[model samples]
Target chain A: MISDSPLLKLALTFGALSLVSVGGAPAMMPEIHRLSVEVNPWLSNAGFARDFALSQTAPGPNFMMISLVGWRVAGFAGLMAATLAAIIPSSIIALIVGRLYMRFSSQAWFPVVKDALPPIVLGLIVASGVVTAQAAVSDTLGFAIVIMSTTIVALTRQNPLVAIATGAIIGLAAGRLGYL
Target chain B: MEQSADSSKTASGRPLGKLELFTGFAEMGLFGFGGVATIARHIIVDKRRWMSEHDYAAVLGLGQILPGGNIINMTVMLGDRFHGPLGSIIALSGLMIMPIVILLGLTLVYDAYAANPDVRAATIGAGAAAAGLVIGMGLKMGRALRLHPIHLGFAVTTFVAMGVLRLPFIATIIVLAPLCIAATWWMRKR
Candidate 1:
């Protein structure tokens, strides 16, 4: 009775995150990872990793991972809760500040905040990469795929989906070969 | 961007309304693969002319450093610009319609076949690649920014706090954000 239901957890988690997701929702991925996989233990490493992959692979903003996580945890209700919670709070703030932003973009403080945030966001993004990698890699072949995929996508202008689809084929081959 | 003195207006120089916002954003939601930034710019500035290049840049620039997803913020801001509070709702609904539907469709398929061994293996593989994709994306951004020394210091600190030490995001960001902003202000003054 003390523990909250998964649906409640989904709402609470995303609602809180939506406000602080300053660097963007993807920047919140590490926190999401920690809560769902480590602290509260709602999803397994593989489950979270799969959801991250699907969310990224799907044709939408990077923020859609909330929907995938919700669906995995509690079906339709979870999906609605997580998506609405993740989106609404921040949208409200944006609505309030947006008018000011357009009018005052050239104001003294605007550029400083803009310049300052990127490095921090970049760091969070790197942390997210690390967290997702931990969830995804269970063996040498899997590890190798991550490294190679990172190299190819980072060094070139190639689309990221190339790396994803290639990894699937490699994994299928490796899995059949019993390497994984 | 060399875009000169153009006033903010749609392509036909007519005022934009909720209908335009909905359809425009719906198009972005449907085809904005990998991300929506590029597609959003193309649609708003080029195809729809809802906003000139200069105006789009100003709003989207502000959108980037603010909270939430960049496109979501852009839509909210742009919706308000074109209409009002209600425009925000319409534009957001436009953006989510196709994405939510497609995401749910994918979810159903995933649930139906997830128990299969082949599917499991592929999912694992795809997940690994996704992890790499994320890392690669971070690296790409790092390259683009050419990190100032101050910026690099903060980036390294943030990375260690989250990735190495596994500190909670809320407290760490609260502590670091002001420090980083102050450092930037100092640098700008110099």
Candidate 2:
């Protein structure tokens, strides 16, 4: 059998993710979750979910999931390569543009870049919401939770953590009762 | 920004040490799960207190508008805040390491049990929670936009057009953006 390098795979997945991860890491959720669970079978859906949760609960950006995906594929080496792959491309661009941005603070193009971005980002973020919803909400109880959460989110100004904790508790209780 | 120079100064005016960056990312990496934005918000405003809340909102708005990732923009901005170019690099590394490590572990378990039923159920549950989180975020963004009634009308219209009508991405951007901009310009003029 030919030796498959998980490290290389991890690098490639995130490298592509870097380029196509428009709007942010969550925007790529549908694709990345599909790739990780369905296409490559590198990580189980549950495992991916847990890793994602961990990534979310932690600090920093959403792109941290790439590291977990990479690490799952090939141990420590995979972890470094994936994290590097996920961050380096954007870092380089930001670094270069940051320098230029500082220099061109007074230029017209800066505002143009600014003006052109909001709608696109809005659309992408909306798409991300759809994609994440598709992967996450499954059963009746789960579906209700999603709708309730969405409604509460829209209607109330309560902190999101309270809502999340509430849903988690409900879900956990439902699981204990075999109602899920 | 108005803080005295001595308040921010350490032993020297040097950038953050490698250790600081590493530990910072690790803490965030380990605990920054759930909605990544919340973690991101904490880093920008609470932990580092780099930018004021208003500035954070402005930058976040701009980041959301641009292509690439919103969190990445925050990372860059925060990096710029703490240590300029070098600081940004450290910050990004600090944020990314933990997730990758976790993902790698998932890959191994996935390879072993791709068809497991319990795993499928867990994924489904998690996905629901994610939806809830997204809804929460959308509400937050909507509130922040503070559009006038007319602009809010546009936002709702646009949301329905894109969300329910399933318009193409470019189509939505092309159609709604100019209208919003024109409306905003007109509103400001009056």
Candidate 3:
């Protein structure tokens, strides 16, 4: 029996996460991993990892993983609830504050706030990278793939999807060769 | 205000109608694999000429400071800029609709292949690459900022607090963001 309560909880949790998802969805990964895996037991670590990969591969916002988690927990209704929860609150704030910022484009505090945010956003992103790498990298081959993909994506204009797809093909070949 | 200037320019030029906004974002949603920011800029600034380069950057800057997904916020702001409240709704929904359906389909496919060893291995590989993507994005953004010492310190501190120590996310931000903001203001003075 799928209870309304868990779905509601899912909505509430993601709704709160929506407000703090600075820099984008990836910034919230560590917390999202902890909450869904440790706090709620809604997903195992591996399950969370797989869903994270799915979200990454999909052509949308990285935060779409939250919806996947909700779906895993409670099906379609959970999906809708979590997706809306993840998008709505912060969007409302964006709409309101965005309008105001346009009006106050020359305010003294605006540029200061903007300049200060990038570093912090960078930090959060790095933290998310750490959390995700810990969860995702399991073997030597996986580590190598991470290093290669990171190098290629950072140093060149190569499409990231190509890198990701290459990683997948390598994994498939490795699995067939009994590397796993 | 720069917003008024951009708005007036948009008004004078061929303004984006609701359907165009929807179709444009829908296309972005479908093909914008990895990150949507570049593709969005291409569509909005280059292909469509809906916004000038400066206007696009300014809007993107504002989007970054606010909460939620940056692209999602971009959709809202861009939508509102052209079409008011209804425009915002249409743009956001367009951005989400196709991706949501496709993701749901992918999830179902993943569940069906969950037990396969090959599929599991490929997922692991994909996951590693995904992590790389995140790290690369951080490095790229950090380089772009040309971070001063203070900013670098704050960024490293944040990484330590959350990545190393595994502190709570919201609490760390609450404690650190104000300090960083003040430091930036002080740096500006000098």
Q: Report lDDT per candidate.
A: 0.84, 0.60, 0.85
Over 4 Å off, model 1:
A1-5, B1-12
Worst 10 residues of 1 chain A by lDDT: A97-106
Tell me the tens digit of each residue's lDDT in model 1 across A38-136.
876678998889888888777778888888788778888988988998999988888877866635676898899989999999999989898899999
Off by over 4 Å in 3: A1-4, B1-12
Interface RMSD list for the candidates: 2.7, 4.9, 1.6
- Which pairs of residues have clashing backbones in candidate 3? none
Over the stretch B1-190, how does candidate 1's per-residue lDDT look in tens digits?
A: 1223433346567878678789999999998777787888989888877877877787787777777987899999888776778888899889888988887887679879998877788888999999998888889999999999989999999989998899999988999998999999999999
**Which docking band does candidate 2 fall into?**
acceptable
Identify the candidate with maximal DockQ. 3
What global local distance difference test value does model 1 have? Answer: 0.84
Q: List, residue by residue over A55-156, the lDDT tens digit for candidate 2.
A: 553444666667667766776787688877876776566555554543554664445445433443444455556555655655678777777767766677
lDDT of 2 by residue, B116-178 (tens): 655444444544665666656666565665545775666566556645565544455567666
Ranking by lDDT: 3, 1, 2
lDDT score of residue B66 within candidate 3: 86
Q: What fraction of the reference interface contacts is present in each model, in order?
A: 0.72, 0.30, 0.74
* Winning candidate number (TM-score): 3
- DockQ for model 3 equals 0.71
